[model samples]
Target chain A: MAFRVVHYINQFFANVGGEEMAHIAPELREGKVGPGMAFETAWKGEAVIVNTIVCGDSYFAEHEKDAKEQVVAWVKEINPDMFIAGPAFNAGRYGYACANIALEVKTQLGIPVLTGMYEENPGADLKDKILITPTANSAAGMRKAAPTMAKLALKLMKGEVLGASCEEGYMPNGIRVNFFEKERGAKRAVKMLINKINGKAFTTEFPMPNFDRVEPGKAIPDMSKVVLGLATSGGIVSKGNPDHIEASSASHYGEYDIEGWDALTAEGWETAHGGYDPVYANENPNRVMPIDVLRQMEKEGKIGKLHRYFYSTVGNGTAVASSRKFAEEYAQKMLKAGVQACIMTST
Target chain B: MVKEIERVGIPVVHMCTITPISLTVGANRIIPTIAIPYPLGNPALTPEDEYALRYKLVDAAIKAFSVDIDKQTVFEF
Candidate 1:
């Protein structure tokens, strides 16, 4: 059976006119339109675009819900084996409409959908949600886009497993795949080094990640009126360390309820922090987190209420990634509890 | 991790015996501890004196949060 496909293009490419014609509602034509003519040439007889659904960029953006439902209803009637959205380059509205409609088409119809857009396109953010072949920055690159989109759509129609992003020329979908290279690590490194020393460019197997530099948040105007929460990397826990967070390289953090409690004692809690000497912190755990003093402050009306629960994790030898994960999770929990400020203690 | 908490907007006064390392790690506010093992108190001091020292540390840290300023700050006891 010839693989049947449905193609989606914006008003401009569908010859519904340019920006002035962008108000056109989505309507299906019998067969290939505009870029689909190029796709037909590329696909040969392997696949045919049985229908072309065209929607105006502005109309689709302003009336997304109605536009999407209308388009999905039409596509459901056509029932193509695969769907293809725009090679929408850098056109923001058009790219957004293409990716948006393509995602719904795949979801409601459960067919493989492919799109193409410039790397910087806002629609590129949807690369993980649907297949998006990398395209040029404008419609001028439609020649390159058509063949790339057709090849991938053809693969999808035939149920062929797609290759890596670099190999297949698509945006990386963030799914990790294991593939052994012909050359061993040592050989590859030597070859890479030779190429680099010869002034030739070499692609690195692993790219360094850029870290976020967060600006400090505005300070609280009045501590007495705000809820205060306590978080610690000192590893002070309730008595036996219920969560069993390791003394070093802790795997998890524990949220202990401290409401109506004034002191942290050696009997009730101890230090799980391995980096520091345990005797003093264990004997008077409050010395580390200063919860006892905070209670005193609350009583003295120096601050509002202390948050009911305190989070504890051991920072000693703990991975940076693990600590970040702990903070991300517990931070949201504290925020939900109305904690406007936090006291983070470390050993 | 102090930097991480501060990054999220809640100001942190890192109470550590090692002040230089705290500043180096980009901790915005810092209060020096009496010792590494027991940051709040000096065990050699009498109970009353120790309480005074701990109170001084916590008071300084909390007070630091009250003041408004730009850039990193260090709170001394």
Candidate 2:
């Protein structure tokens, strides 16, 4: 008997009217709707989409809680072996609905779920919570997305352990999965180095996340009136590390009071960062954060007052995503506190 | 992280030993520091000289806040 799979998609992919039909609510059809045919072909009798759940993008966006409840109820009734949602491409609302519905089914029904979308789709933000295969920016990529999704779906149905994101075609979700490679680490690195020197195209095993450049903020008009903020990834912290920030891959940041501090003494402060030699920084924590010098400038009226609080986190091996989250959270606080300028240090 | 702070409209200068990584990460204003272990201070110097060196670097970083830059820039010390 073929394994049962339940598929979800928005109205446009269900052969329902496009923008005009976007207000339609949730409905479940018997089997094998538009894109389901592609999954069927790829499944090759190993699994069959027993049911298809269709919801309009606008309806889901407007009535998200209700739409999700309805879809989850229907999926529970079907109780398929696995669930799949749209390769929603670049349609924002549809991608969001597909990713959310897939997440709901997986959590509520305890079933495996998969979805696909363009890498930049807002839905891709949920990639850490669900499996999302990257697709092209438009529906034209369906031919490729289908087979890739289907192969992974089949693996999930068979209860097989999955490989790394690069091996399995899913976005890197922060969860590191270990797997064996044919070549040893050193041998593979040497080959990659050779490829690089010869100008041959080579894929990096650890690719840096795409960084968005931000326009520089307007310059402060007068340094004497600016409230300077201090932050660091060099991991300077209170001597006891009261917040207990990890030495590497720090998951959180520490905010400390420096209202009257003139210097970071060896007994009062230390570096929690494991990436570098800690001796110098431990002897004078200001080497990493430079709070002492900033305080001197403040006293001399060279600059306005230093913000009383300093933020610290270890940058050693920290994920870019984690670092971004930390900064976003604190930047809002700094703004509210009237910080006009900031100095950030990293080791 | 420096970029994130800048994204929120706060002028920020990154002081670090590795200027290339700071540039790669899209910091707008950067100040190259002395070394990874002692970015602002040199233990080889007397405490007074070390404090002066750190004061100079921090001063440069403060200067970065007021400089108008259209692209990623390193504020040389």
Best by lDDT: 2
**TM-scores of the candidates in the order shown:** 0.62, 0.81
lDDT of candidate 2 over B1-77, digit per residue (tens): 98889888899999998999999989999999999899999999999999999999998988888898899999875
Query: What is the alpha-carbon lDDT of model 2 when measured against the actual structure?
Result: 0.92
lDDT of 1 by residue, A1-347 (tens): 78888889999999889999999989889889989999999988888889998999999999999999998998898888998998899999989998999999989989999999999999889999998998889889988888888888888888988777777668889977676788999999999999999999998888744345445556666778878888888888988888898989899999999876787777888888888888888888877878778888888887898889998998888887888789888877876888777776666
Task: State the C-alpha lDDT per candidate.
Answer: 0.83, 0.92
Model 2, runs deviating above 4 Å: A62-79, A180-202, A217-227, A242-260, A291-301, A304-309, A317-340, B7-10, B62-68
Score residue A171 of candidate 2 by CA lDDT: 86
* Clash list (residue pairs), candidate 2: none
Off by over 4 Å in 1: A140-143, A187-204, A207-209, A215-230, A233-266, A270-347, B1-77
Ten contiguous residues minimizing lDDT sum, candidate 2 chain A: A202-211
Error of 1 at A160 (Å): 1.1
What is the TM-score of each candidate's chain B when compared with the real chain B?
0.88, 0.96
